[model samples]
Structures are given as C-alpha cells and as structure tokens.
Target chain A: MTHATLALLTLAACAPAERGRTLVIAAYTTPREVLSEQLLPAFREDWRRRHGEEVRFETSYQGSGSQSRAVAAGLEADVVWLSLEPDVERLVGAGLVTGDWRGTPTGGLASSSVAVIGVREGNPLQLHSWADLEREGVEVLTPNVRTSGGAMWGVMAIAGAADRRGADPLRALGATLARVRVMDKGARESMLSFEKGVGDAIITYENEVVVARRAGVPLDYAVPAQTIRIENPAAVVDAYADRHGTRDLAEALVAFLGEAPQQEVMGRYGLRPVREGVDCPDLPALSEVFTVRDLGGWEAVQGRIFADGALYDQALSLSRGQR
Target chain B: MSVRWGLAGWAITAGVALWVGALVALPLAAVGAEALHRGPGPALAAVLHPDALRALALSASLATWVAAVNTVGGLAVAWALVRWDFPGRRLLAAAVDLPFAVPTLVVGVLFVALLGPNTTLGRALEAAGLRVVYAWPGMAVALCFVTLPFVVRAVEPVLAELDPAEQEAARTLGATRWQVWSRVVIPPLIPPLVAGGGQSLARALGEFGAMAVVSGNVPRETLVASVYVLGEVEAGQVGDAAAVSLVLLALAAAAQLAGRRAGRWLGAA
Candidate 1:
C-alpha cells in the first residue's frame, strides 16, 4: 500500500504542472530583441503577480511582409506587432483577427517613430534635408520598398516632403533613389550595411539610430524639418487567442503595453509614445509630420505608388535608364 | 517470362511514388499552375518587365562568368592537388570544399567583412575607384565563392584516375610539357569540366542568400532573378513571383540537361 501511494505521488509529480498558456507574438525583426529582452520579462512578471500562474512566450521575427503572410497562412499567432498597418489589415482580411484592432489602442497605435538620416560619426556630406540625399557623390543606403514596411515609409517621407515643398514628388523621389548605392531587403539589413560603411548616409528609423548609438557605434542622425510619422500597431489576434483560450491574457498584454510604464520603456528603446505627454528626449521633434493617411491611406498608397507600372516602378525604370 | 512485382513490392513502389509526387511534383505543379492561371498575357508581362528582364540578364551573365572562372581555376587547383606534392596541398584541397559546407549567407557576410567599406582593403578599393561591396564585381566574387567547390570536386576524381604514364610517354617522345598537356590531359578533362561548369552555372542562377547581401539588389544593376522573385512575393504579388520562379526553374533545368548531355557525349568519345 505504501509503494502504491508513493508511485501515485511520483506519477503526479512527474506530470506537468497545470497547463500554462503560451502567447506567440509575430513581430518585425527590429523590435524583436527589445521585445524578448525587456518587454516580455516585465509582462511575464506582471502576469504572474496578477493571475498567480506562469506564462510563456514565443516570438517569430521576420521582415514585416513575410511575418504578415505567415500569420495569414495560419501561423496561429496570439498577437502581432508588425511594422505597418497593411500587415495587420492582411490578417483582418484573412479572418484571423475579427475585431476592430485599429480602434482598440490609443489612436490605433502602440508606438511611433519617424524617418531620419543616419550619417557617419562626422557628417561629411553636411546632409540636413531630404534634398541633400540627391546631391552629387552622396550615396544613400535604403531598403527595397517592396519588401520592407519601413522602406516604404522612408520613400513616402521623401516624396511627401517634396510635394509639400511644391516639387514633383516622382522626380524628387527618382533623384533620391538614383543616389541609393545599396538597397537592402529591410530596414535592419540596411542598417547592417550602413554599419559596414556601405554608404555615406542611410535613411532609416530614428529609433534605429538611437539603438546604434547606445551600442557605441559612432553615428549621428538628422531629422529633417518634414518627415513622416511611423506608427507601429499591436493587436490581439482574436481568432487564435479565442481558440487557445488565451483571449483575456492577450487583451491584457496589449493593454499593458499602452500603459505609461511600458510606453516609457518603448521610448527608451527609441519608439515615440502613442499617448501624449510622455516625454522621450531621445526622439527628435519635427516641424511637419505626416502619416499614411495623408497619402490616401494604405490602400490608395498601394495602388498609386506601389502597384504595377506605378509611380515607383516608373521612377525606378527612369533611374535605371539614367545609369 | 515477364518479371513482375508482388503485392508488397507494388505497394512499396506506390508509396514511394506518392511521397515524391506530393513533396516535389506538387509544388512544381503549383508554381506552373499559378504562373499560367492568369493566362499568358500577365505571365509574359511580368517576365518582360524591365526590372525582371534586367535581373534575368544580370544573373545569366554573372553565372556564365562564374562558370568560366571556376572551370579554369578549378582545373588548375585539381591538377596541382593530383599531380604534385606540396606543403599545405591537403589543406588547400579541403578548403576548396569549404564553400559547399558553409552556409551561403555566411559566405556573403565573410565577403562583406573582408571587403566592406569599413575594412582597409575595401577603403583602398574604394579610393582606387573600384567598388566591390555593392557592385557587379562583388556579385561575381560571391557567385565564385559559393560555386567554387562544384568544379574542383567534379574534376579532382577524374584527374586522379588519369594515367601519368601517358604524359611520361609523350615526354619521352620529345613532346614539350605544353604539347603533352594540350593533347592528352585536355581531352579527358573536358568532359568533367563541362559537367562541373554546368553545375556551377545552375547553382549561380538560383543563388539568393549570398547575392542578397553582397549585390545590394539595385533594381537595374545588382538585383538578380531570385531577389526579384522575393521582392514580388513580399509585395504580395504571388502570381508574378510564381511566374518569375518558373522561368528560373526552366533555365536551371535546361542547364542541367545540357550538362548531362555534354558529359555523355564527351564520355562516349
């Protein structure tokens, strides 16, 4: 009888502790390190304190478009913090996210950033404006707009600034692109090339510049007077969370990211807060800021700028002809 | 009497066929179906776009150069390894196959570290008005690095089996070294060289990871066909991506077939 009792105890002890939920976050590559290193640990601690249960996390990081497709093709992600709105909208279209995700967070935004130019330690080109990128002998490093959400935003920022200044946006964009010495697949890869000193200047996110500086890379960034605001949205994947019985936890996690403390964490990591009155000294101020909505939103931008034989294609062909 | 499979044999054959059909044949069929699903017009348009055409042209040209360079260099290295005794010859032989073992992406990173703008060599090249990292030369170098082993491995075995007695006879007959090599050594090496060169060409055609880092993917300049396909897929143009991919597959298959045919012809001769 004692042997039987001990066997039962051993079996019970060997079995897994009560089933804990694993929240899978599909995110773009740039923020993945920070999410794993800072955000996730804090969230796990907070969740443990509140629910009296342990939680685990799995992260999938890739270029935003690739991550979007993975989720659309049924990767079963509980949350998606992608680089652009189109990626989330893709999930919504595929019925993976049934809720109004955009309306849930503040301004439908979790974090924000703006495009800036990262120059070598000493700015040899004296680059201060978008026009400087088109100057002779000023090789620019940027990513392909087709593959990178951040690159798309950088392109838009250049064209929008040109349009606001009463120049032909296509021509201005063409001239700037003509100066691009190397076009990487994503913002992070472009930054890698920049770190390798591939180009004289690289148009990338302000947050990336901050991160590089913190890593002790000798670099400086310039925020032009006019730049586009890059808004990164986070949302609970309604279908997956509901199916996995993690809907409540996913919702709580997204909400926690918007709270002041987490927002400050984001700011320290180089993202601007979606909420107002949160001071992020590292983030530079811009006199004129535009959003995707200003360029007829994602749908229109996709059709007009990125569609087959669209402005971008035409400009690229022209640049090639010039070369 | 006809030899026939029993029930179990038939079942096993059917199972193997089913597995291969599902894994290999299915995806290829899907690509063809997707490419032509929208009809010939869109497929042709996608393939004929200036950017796609440029990529195709650049990849083909680069692959040809890489194949030629590897054929010559691979022959020299294989001969040196097989025909002579030298210090570090074993190490050199092993290092020739390093490209095959290391990941192509790591090969790209290695090239960048060695010749990026931050390095002294890269800066010197830059100052001399030669751009290596994000230029045609860089793409060629990357293709060469990844495909180096194909030709050397193919030719080394063939060279080893060649009789040294033939060369000795030619030398005793008062033939010069060049004449002996040109008449005897060149003929047998031709078959393997063609085979290896074709394999290298096929590989360079589909290369993506290394060129993605080394070539800078400029649309009209450095972008290769594989990168263009990736760009299409990332842009959510699945049909276009499929179309471009089919073209590449056809090119690779053609090259492989040609290689095999040439090898057979040479072997028979």
Candidate 2:
C-alpha cells in the first residue's frame, strides 16, 4: 500500500460538490412497467430540478410474500412498496417501518386495482362471477393464499360475494378451491399458467388482465359484481432510510406515486389510481366493492381467515373431503 | 521430521477441522437448535400435523420413485457407454453428466415447456387422460432428471473395472450367455447400484426448485415436505418451517449415511 501525501490529506475529498444519492426500492412484482418507465424516471427528474444533484435508484421486485420477508430480514431497501396492507403490516411488526405510515404519505396507499377474472376469448363458458368458477368441469387457476398476499384478495372477494348472497363463505371457498386445477405460488405465475393454456379461467387482478391484453394476448376479463378493492401500499422503511440517509428521496418517490402525474401513468399502465379524480375511463367500475376495512382490518382478517387452523385450513380440508 | 514440517501438518489438520466445523456443522446445528427452540414436543407435533404428514408421505414416495427409476436408467446408460462402441459414444458419455451441471430450476422450466398443457405432446397426453405437468408424473420426472447423474456416475467405474477374461473363461466352461452374465456380471454391480440408488433417494428427498414448479402445491394432495416448509416460511411461521426442515434433513442425512455404508461394504468407495 502506498502512503498518502500531505496534499491529498489536506484536500479531504470525501463529499463531492455534486454528490449523488441512491434510493433503493423493494416492490412487488406487479406495477413493474409503470414504476420503471414513468414513476421512477419522473421522480428522478423532479428531484434533480429541485436539488441540482443526481439521484440514482436501485429496485428489486418479487412476490409480495417474499418481498416483504426480504425487507424484514434485512434487505436494506429505502422504500418498500407491496401488493397489500398486511405485507406492510409485517414490516411494521418487524419494526422496519413506522407505525403511522397510513396517516401520512397518502394513507400509505400508492395505487389500486380490483380483483377480476380472465377467461378465454369470446367467453364461451361465460364465467361472470365467482359462482361461475364453482361450476362443475370449470377449471380455475389461483395462487396459494399461504404464499401470496395478492392471492388473499381473490379469496376475500369470492368469500365476500358468497356472503352477500346468503351462502356460506366457507363452503363457497371450499368449492372454488376444489375446482382449482392449477395453483402457483404467486398471482403472476398463475397468470403465466393461464397464458400457457393451463386453465379455463384465472382469478387475478383487473390490471393483470388489462396489461396482458395490451401485450396482445387474446383474453377477456369479467369484473365480478361483488369484488374487493386491491390497495397496494408504499412506505419508506424507517431503519433502512435512516441508515442510508435517503429518507427524503424515498418518501418523495412514494408520495409522487399518489400525485396526479404519476397516478395518471399508473392508470395508463393498468393500475387504478389511489386518488378519486384521476381519469381512467377505460377501466370499468365495480358493481359492488368492499375495502379491507369494511370487513375488518388486516390483523383481524388475517387471523380469522388465513391463520393456522383457521377458515383457510378448514376450506382446504373441506375441499379435500369433497374430492 | 523437522519442527517446520511437524508444525505445518498440525496446522493443516487443525485448519481442515475448523473449516468443516464452521461451514458444514454449524449451520446444521443451528437448524436443529431452531427446531427445538420451543422444545422437542412442539417440533414433534409440528411434523405430525395433518398437512405436514401428507407432505412427508408425498416426499417419501417421490424419493422412492426417483431411486427406482434412476437405478434402472443409470445402469442402462452406464452399460451402453462401457460395453458398446456405438456411433457418438463420446458424445453420449459427455451428455450423461449434463444434468449435474444444469440448475434444477431450469430443468423444471424445461420440463414445463416441453410437456405442459400447451404443447402438442402435452395435449395428446392430456387427451389420453395421462396428466403429466402439475401432477404426480411431472413431479417424479423432475426429481428423476435431477438425480440421474448420481447413479450413472456411481455405476460407471464399477462396470468398467470388470474383466473380459473372466467372462470369457466362464463362457468357455459350458456356461450359457445368460448364466455367465447373471452369475458373474450381476453380483459385482449390485453394491454400486444400491449405493447409487441411495444417493438418488437422498437427493430427491431434499429437491425444491424443480418440485416447486412442477407440483401444483395443493395441500394434503400434491404438496411435498420441502414446499410445505416454504409455505410455512412465507406464512410467517419460521418455527414450523424449521421443524419440518429438521425432519427432512434427518431423512436425507440417514439416506446419505446408508449410501456411504453400502459403498464401504463392497469397497466401492
């Protein structure tokens, strides 16, 4: 090793005049196009105009379950954007995110998409509602709820519709899973399976169907009468942002997602806007919709439906018994 | 010996011990400790849960099928390369080791593309009512593909060492081809075949990447133990994942030890 000279020591060139910062984002698999193309770039431009310094971004995308677990297990992401509220709740429980994220930064919600069903072209089977999926000989594709937070939204939609009709939600869930011939770990994988001609119908997001259709895959989607609103949350991880000193940049990107310009990009890319006035005329309105808060909060619903020995386990056993 | 040489040997031995202790033994010990962190009772109960039991049974059956298929397939491949001077013999020999080099996840995706519902063969198979992908057949095939190299590599050395002179003498002694082959050729190959099958069984038990893609992951029906551990982890039940993993690790470890013992019994090692 060469010894440093006195001139170099006197220079003390640690901080450059145009210092750069990195904002790391760990997000769910969906919304990859919008975030990479419009939201992130727009935020970078906005930050450069204000601060006159360059800001770089690093992003990783995975299924909500794995992505949330990665943040909790020390991925050091400045921002954690995920599919559902429970995933953000996991980080809060891990003490990686602030407890009151929902009160600020746009109620901790970045974008929205309602659960919908995708079927073959022309709707030969006419699978309109969740009840249509329970028909005999109709093969349904869904992800395992145990491994996917997005999958939980699909289950809740069906169960909520079943409850609305005075039918037993548990039995309805059992019947739906019985016809589930293809179940993958993530909703995206389930969609791929559907694209590969593996299933008669796929229970997924409206945005997924819209995105796939825009990509020229010949498919049609049915927005069920009674559906669940999918609210995707984005927040700055507290400990990670503090450690990286990128909290302001991280917070700005998330807040930008809920603003008019980026929210319009989110709508164009198929994800619904979190704000009410953002115009996405092509996206259909849900006939009847419910939020997670309408049923209960994330903690209550998680325990009641998905906990061990809970309703999902009962549904599995019931479905097996039916088989 | 001089003091330098003596010191070097002692240091080398200690270094090896430390390396193995840290790299191999410590992680396994941590798994065991985590499994029993809530005590052995909960760990036992975790494995004995209904879903866990079903997953364990599925995993064991997959291992058994992989072992049987690999043993037969591996012997045929090994026999062909050793006994025949056919066209493209060297290419065939090189191809036998390809499975070991390929990542098993890619192997799973390859199987999916070749035999999934969209393909012509896959469609014909479905029309014939033989569901392959997302079913038992696909899981078995995926496991067998990943483990085939173990048995083939194991049997090749033993098969190549057999002497032509001994078989010729036996044939000259009024022994028919079948009798000569059965009596002389078969007995010596048994130990290596068993050893190879054992290795295949151990490997199949712990396989995750391929099985994850091929199996539909339905609980109590198609879900295997390793995938079940993944589900538990994704569900935020790390304790349950550790317990089930401990059980799988024990079974795989037992299979490996059995294979080593069989190899040593015939000095095949």
Candidate 3:
C-alpha cells in the first residue's frame, strides 16, 4: 500500500510536465457543484463544437484563500474562480494574473450572493437581524475568518449591522461569537453543522441556504435587513495560461460563466447574477444591502477590521474571555 | 570486530544522508528562514502573540491529557491482551491496531457524527451541561482517538516478554496485589510505559486533522498549534505560520529527546 501510494504520488509529480488540451481551473469549494454539474459540461460541449476537438477540463477546489495561495505558490492553474476580490488582488500582487483582469464582465465579478442567517425549522428562536444572534442562550455557527472567505463575510455582516445601529462593532461581533458554539473551517461546514442540529443559527451565504434547501434539507434562512452583498471573482492566470497556451480557452470559460444562460444556472444554484436581469427565485429582496466598497473596500477594511489587534481579532479574543 | 567501508556501504550511507537532508533538513531550514528572515524580533513577537500563545497552551494541555489517558488506557489494554485467555482475544488485539490504520480525519468525523447534538446521547450530555463537540472534551477525545495506538503498540512487546514466573513468585511470597504490582511487575514496565507515553505526547502535540474537525477552533479557546499554523497560512501570514511552526518544532524536538533520555535512564535503572 505504501509503495503504491508513493508510485501514485510520483506519477502525479510528473503528470504536470505534459499540459495537454485541458483548461485547468482552480476554484473555491462552494462552486464545485455548479461548475462540475452544469457550467463545465456546457463549456466543454461548446468548446468541442467551436474548436472541433474535445477540450479536457481539470479542476481543483479549495477554500478561497487556500486556492489563491496555491495558485501563487505555482499551482499552474489556467484560471482561478475565487470567493472574494481580495483573493484576486493577492494573485495580482503576486504577479500571477498580470492582465487588467478586473476590466472583464461585471467588473470582474462572475457571481454574487447576500449574507444571511440560516435557522432551524419554524424559526423557533425568532432570529431576524444580526442583533438577534447575540441573544442569551442562542448557539450560532460560523466559520473561522482565517480559513474561510464566508466567515469573513459573516463577521463583516455582523460588524456592519452593529456599526449601522450605532453599537460598538467589536463588542457586537464578540457577543455574537461568544454565542457561537461551533466555528467550522468554512461556510459549507458551518451550514452542515447547523443541519446536524448543532446550533440554533448559522451566519452564512444566502446561496448556502438555497443549495441546502434544494438538496431537500428542511433548512430556512432570512435575509437580514442589513447585509453584505457577496461578490466572487473569476480571472485568467496570465502566466499559466500563456505557458499552457490555453489563454483563449481559459478566457472563454470565464466569459461563459457571466453570460446570461450560465447566470441562470448559477441563480438556480443560489448565486445571484453579476449580470443584470437574472433572477434567483430562492433569493428574497433584502431590504437594505451593501458591498465591500461601502464598508470601505477590501484594503481599508483589512487592517482596521481584520489585522492583528484589530476589531475582529479583539472580538475573537473577547469571545473566549477578555485578555 | 572492525568493519571497513566498501563502495556499497558508501552508496548506502550517501542514500540515507540524501533522504535525511532533503526530507528533514531542507524543510526545517526553509521554515527557519521564513520565520527568522525578518530578524529575531518579529519572530519572537509572532510566537509570543496572544493568539499564538493561547494556541500553544491549548495544544500542550490537550497533548498532556491525551498522553496520560493513552498511557494508562493502553497499559490496561496491553495487560489484558497479554495476560487474558478470552474468546475474542485475537479480535480485540487486532482491533487495538485499527485506530492506527484509520485516518485521523476519519476519527474526527466519527466523534462529531456520534456525539452530534441531534443524537439522543448527545442531547443528554448537553442537558447535563457537558458539551463535547466544539469543546475541550471533544478536542481531547479526538486527540485520544488518533493517539490510541501509540502507547499500546510500544508497550505490548515489552509486556509480553515479562516472565510469568517472577509474578507468581511474588504472589507465592504472600505479596498483596499492589505489592506484587509495584515490587515485582512495575519496575520492568516503567521503561516501556514512559517511552510509550512520551511517544503519545509527541504525536498528540502535532495532531491536526482530527483536532481541526472536532475542536470548534475558536481563537484562544479551542485552537491548537497545528490548526493555528494552517490558519496563519490561509490568512496569508506565511511568516507568522513559520514562526509558530518553528516554536512547535522546537518543543516537539525537546519532548522527543526528553522521552528517549528518560526511557534510557529508566531502563538502565
């Protein structure tokens, strides 16, 4: 068994030497289903018709931050679909995606979502707003910010709502986090923990609840009065694409994702369309919505909100007990 | 007898040296470079960071607990397997090795699945004010599950080699159960037990897969050093990751050396 595993790993090590007619995609975990089940097939079918040959697809899914790091560490992915703009920014900073990648469709956003609170059947605790999560004796589930893009979104939603209400954002986040019984590694894990009857509530993506309900889970969710609009970016990694000569194929795949028909599939799968006029029936109209730009873009918020000794860090410490 | 080195011996020595250099020395030096490249000040600050300290403390306590439990439990199980003539003796002996065979990640999933809040036993435990999953108990249990075989595998052979006649002689001398255990049985067992316990401690300290799943990983509460390093890497803090890892690597080396030295001392005594 050990020898077999070593042989397989050796094979994998050498396999990257030959880059065949394959569009290698590195993506965050949540979009795995949509990309594999619907989008990739459609793209492959279209590619075969256009190029008169089958274009094989190779995909790897991981947490957004991890995916970005992997690509930066020379994962040789022709394209990267990540959960946030900051991740794409990291690639650009690493000089991996050198093109004016943000000049693409929907200002570089391929899919969108809104922050939400997923609750158990019947909404027994009556959770409606971010403040509701801080109520005494309510167990909440959220992912860890360091490992999960979704967790960052969840924290921003909580802190943003608290800021909007003139409350101390750090205190509010700390209070809500104190009530969190389980902080899973990612948004999907947090939702899974909620589904397993772990917590009274979970702060997650609207698309998460949508996907869950579609999978026949009796999960219910609420779009808070104030929430952060989620944006997921897709870009071609110029270096890898140029190396593999798959720049066109990779670019086409990125473009194919934002087209109206593909946007419809993403909608049914719970992602809001970055493009106009695409409806996701599962997503309710949130009364008030904001974006990362509104919260002072990713740059302004990074150090002030998430860096060491910042609001989020202090809140995390406060969740356990004050220093 | 003095043996002279041949070409084959030289090739073998070179092969082993290359393996150690490439696999162990290279990564260690790389981590050290990443950690200390900014000078000792930032590296020290990173390790001494409040969150990093908390994670270190949590991992230490969890490893201590796992080592103690596995040592005692493993001894009992090994004793039973060596001494008893039971129907399922062979099956039980084989089952003890299963924990080693199963992936640590699967061990974590097993604990979470069984003790989930929705389960009846889990609800009862919660009602009793003892939440397991996402709590310290869950973390300890997960670590224990993964580190179970360490002590058992280490002690079993040494235990099997003990002479039955000596134990019987102590009994014949009218020594009480405790007397026989302490005076006749325990001295020989001490070396293996300490060796096994130390091995368990070292393994538990670095356990990531199971603890990552079972522990809620809330900062300053459930986060352990290994998981904290992963978190740092994900957050794009490679320097912080390397610094935390350097600290852990030093501690693990200290622990393994201590265990081996102590085991040798005990055996000699």
Candidate 4:
C-alpha cells in the first residue's frame, strides 16, 4: 500500500468506542431525521432534568411499512414514530401496544396530507386534479405507494379521486398510472428523481414540495380538488418502554410533540399541524385546505391497489413488448 | 510440536472460524429460518408478487445480456491492450478503469445530463421519436457502465500471462488467425470469464444506485428486484420483503450453478 493509505489506516485504528445512553428509535424518512436531530435533543435534555435520566437517540430512518415490519420482526425499538396510522395498527395487532393508542398516548399527532401532483415550472399540462394526470404526455411521477408512507396518502388521494368521479375511477387512474415515467421508492428518492428530469410532474407530499422548492428544485405542487390528510401517528412502544422503565419519559416526549414546541419543528420541515391555528408562512394551514381521507384502512388499501402488484405486471408487459 | 505455538494456532483457528460463523452463517441461518415460515406459502407468494416476479425476470435477462456484451467487449479491449502499441497506451489502461473509479450514481447522473430532455442529444433523440432516459435501454446502459470493469480486469492479466510463442507457432503451422484464436487462445480464458461473469451478475443484480438515478424506477419496466424488495419492506411487510430477498438469493444461486455447468461444458469441448 502507498504511504498515505497506510497512514490513513493507522489513524483509523485509534477511533474511540461509541458513547452515550442509546435510545433505539425507528422512524420514517426525512421528517423523522429532522425531528431527532433538531427537536429530540432538546427534549432529551428536558427529560434528564425532570427524570434524572440521560438518553440519546440512535435512530434508523426507513419507509413506514418497513419500519413497522422491523418492529414486527423484533427489531427492538424503544419507540416508533411512523408516517401513518395503518403502520401503528400493525403493532397493535402484534400485541406490542396496549389498548387504543389515541387514548393511551399524549393525544395523537396526525396533521399531514398525502401527495399532490407537482408540475414543472410552467404548468404545461394545464392540469388540475387526478383527472389531469390521465392526460397524454403528462408523465406523472409518484413514490411507490406500496413502500412509502406518503404513498399511502397518495393512494388514498387516488381512491378519493375515484369516489368523486363516481361510477368508475380505476379506469382513469390506470391511464394516469401508465403515463407515470418513474415511481420512486420513497419521498426523498422521488424528489431527487423528479429534479433529475425523470418526468413532467411528480405526486408527493406538500411538505416535500416545499422542501424541494426551498432547495431550488424547479417544481410546484398543485393540490387537487380532493386530497387525503396524512395522519402521522407516534406512540411509545409501551411493552418495550415499560420493560425498560422509560415509560414516564416516553410519555413526556410524545406529549411534547403535540404542543407548540414540536409544531415549530414540524413547521420547519413543511409538516402542517394536526390541529388548526399553528400557522407557518410557507405551508398551507390545516383548516383552510380541503384534504381527503382514505375510505378504507391500510389493509383494504393495500389489498386493492398494491397487494397483487398487477399494475406493475401490466406496465412491464407494455414496455417489454415495445422494446 | 511446540506447546506455545500449538495452543496459539488452535486459538487463532477457533477465533477465525467463530468470527466467520457469526458474520456469514448467522445471516444465512436467519434467511433459512425465515424461508421456512408459513410452510413456503409466504416465500412463494413473495416471489410471485407480480411486481417482484417481473423485476426478477427483467433483472435476470438484463444481467445475462450485460455479461455477454461485457465478455466480447472485454476480450477485445484486453487483446488491444496486450497486442497493440497505440499512442497513450498507459492513459488507455487508466481510462479502462474509469468506470470503476467513478461512483455508479454519478454514472447514472452523467447519462441523464447527456440524454435527458434538457440536453441537445435528448432533443435530437426526441426529434427522431426515440426515448432513452426512462426506458429499458437506459437500464441496460446503466448496468453496462457498472459491470464494465469485471470482464476487463479478469481477462487482462490472463491475456498478459499468455505467451506470444503459442500464437506464432499456430501461424507458422499455416493456421488462420481465427483458428489460432478459437483453438489455442480461447480455451484457458474460460475460467476467468466465468468468474468475471459471475461477479458481473452479482453486481448487476444488486445494483440500485444507477437504476435509481437514471432508469426512473418505473414499476415492472425499470423496478429491479433489489428495489422491489426495498419497496416491500417499506410497505410494512417484513415477511414479504424477507421472502423476496430469499427468492432473489435462490435465483442468484441457480444462476451461479448454471454458469458453473456451462463453464464445465465449455471446458470439456
């Protein structure tokens, strides 16, 4: 090896062991990271003062479903702050949580909206609502709903669109789904992919669009006539936390997220408050805009849209036969 | 035997075996254990998911084509590097390794810059009524870029070790150039080619970065098995994701076995 390489290797050998009291956390994507880094440290300090316990977060960021699966598969999470409600329901089903979570925890944290169509700067399609996505040359892009929390919301929004249209909406959706040039696996991946010119428009969360726009991505979010409100649910993994005797602290942290201090952090990340009147300049206030709700729970949604993966099969068959 | 040395050797061997057992065997065991869950129903269902199955089929075909292309192209490039005295020969050698040095994500981004709708080449292609960015062709291009090094690195050293006297002797016997290559030169290169092809297949199958940046991750058309497994995991279906991964592992193992059998058959011929 070269001298520089040898020296570098020698320096690496002197690295210190990890320190601090680690709190294992499972969260979904960008919002979780911002919450942990910017918000949680302050909360941790507060907990130390009140309870005389020191804890630092060691977190993993993944898709909502994936995080839920990890918990199901015994990933040993102290707390799970997820992107949607259905994921939390899985934990309850697994018996990791006790009773209804909304009654047990610090109220509930649920105030985000599902993805909307984010168009190019010029608005070339003259597009509005889910129907506009069905137009030819539209080239829609959305994170795969099967994997992303935002995608769950997006699926609800699509289903809501079908409901508004009445009679038949899948036919309209299928055509729009066909025009989608890319389906990113996650929200951030979708953002980056969209910025790289993969498609004419993207369907992602309003907050993601705000973040992207702040980063100077040439995109604009157009809220359709009806869109789903993203109901993000956070809860202390009761059995795990109670076993560790961190229950009081865990309750406090979850409660803290419900109040104004946590709202400030969510606001910075483009997450609208779950309740009304905690206004931020850039984001749409929760009360003003019309956000749609999914008619079914996670299971039903998965069963209809993503369970069989038929859509993917059709898309592949179409592309393969072409080239 | 020296007592001190013997004890040290036994301890060292035990330590190494234990480390390997923990690192590799445990994960493999977990996969096997999980595979046995639901009596193979979940495993079969996971692999049979339309999106995953499509990705599996697409990834396999793409890997095969990419490996074949690399085999021929790599051999030609190795031959030129060894047999010719072109200007900037050293520079050419460095350039051949360029794909390895650059990150795969950057390679995908580079293609986007060159062929995206924003670029002149993109406009030209657009005018020709052709699309390259979000198509199967783009995926092939990305896979080719990442796997380019394997075949070249495998063959180059082997080709260098080959003596020139064998080629000269064949020519002296009035054998044609093609005859010399087919009968004398191609035989020993089989092992390295198989090795390179296997490595390339593994790399191409696991590839996510390039496809993520360039091919658009469109369902079925561009969603590779790795990305699809990730999608399942993200959907809060660990059992399904693990099942998909188990299926991918099985497919990879089968491909390797087929490659070995083909190598043996070619060697016998």
> Candidate 1 has which clashing residue pairs, if any?
none
Q: What is the number of backbone collisions in each predicted candidate, taken in the order shown? A: 0, 0, 0, 8
What tens digits encode model 1's per-residue C-alpha lDDT throughout B189-230? 888898999999999999988998788898988899999998
Q: Give the top-scoring candidate (TM-score).
A: 2
lDDT of each: 0.87, 0.86, 0.86, 0.73
* Candidate 2 clashes between residue pairs 3 or more apart in a chain or in different chains: none
Q: For residues B1-269, could you state the per-residue lDDT of candidate 3 as single tens digits?
A: 13456777888999999999999999999999999999999999999999899999989888988889998999999999998889999999889888789889888888988887888888999999898988899889888878888788888888889988988998998999899898778787878788888888888888888888888777787889999999888877899999999988888777777877887798788
Sorted by DockQ, highest first, which candidate order results? 1, 2, 3, 4
Show model 1 residue runs off by greater than 4 Å.
Answer: A1-19, B1-27, B171-179, B266-269
For model 4, the stretches where C-alpha displacement exceeds 4 angstroms are A1-26, A30-60, A72-79, A104-107, A243-245, A260-269, A276-323, B1-33, B40-42, B91-134, B161-195, B206-214, B233-247, B254-261, B264-268
Between 2 and 4, whose DockQ is larger? 2
> TM-scores for all candidates?
0.90, 0.92, 0.91, 0.79
Candidate 3 residue pairs in backbone clash: none
Predicted complex 3: CAPRI docking category: medium
Give a tens-digit lDDT track for model 2, residues B11-83: 9999999999999999999888888999999889889888999999999989998999999999999999998
* iRMS values for every prediction: 1.4, 1.5, 1.5, 3.1
DockQ of 4: 0.45
* Candidate 2 deviant stretches above 4 angstroms: A1-19, B2-13, B176-178, B262-269
- The TM-score between candidate 2 and the true structure equals 0.92
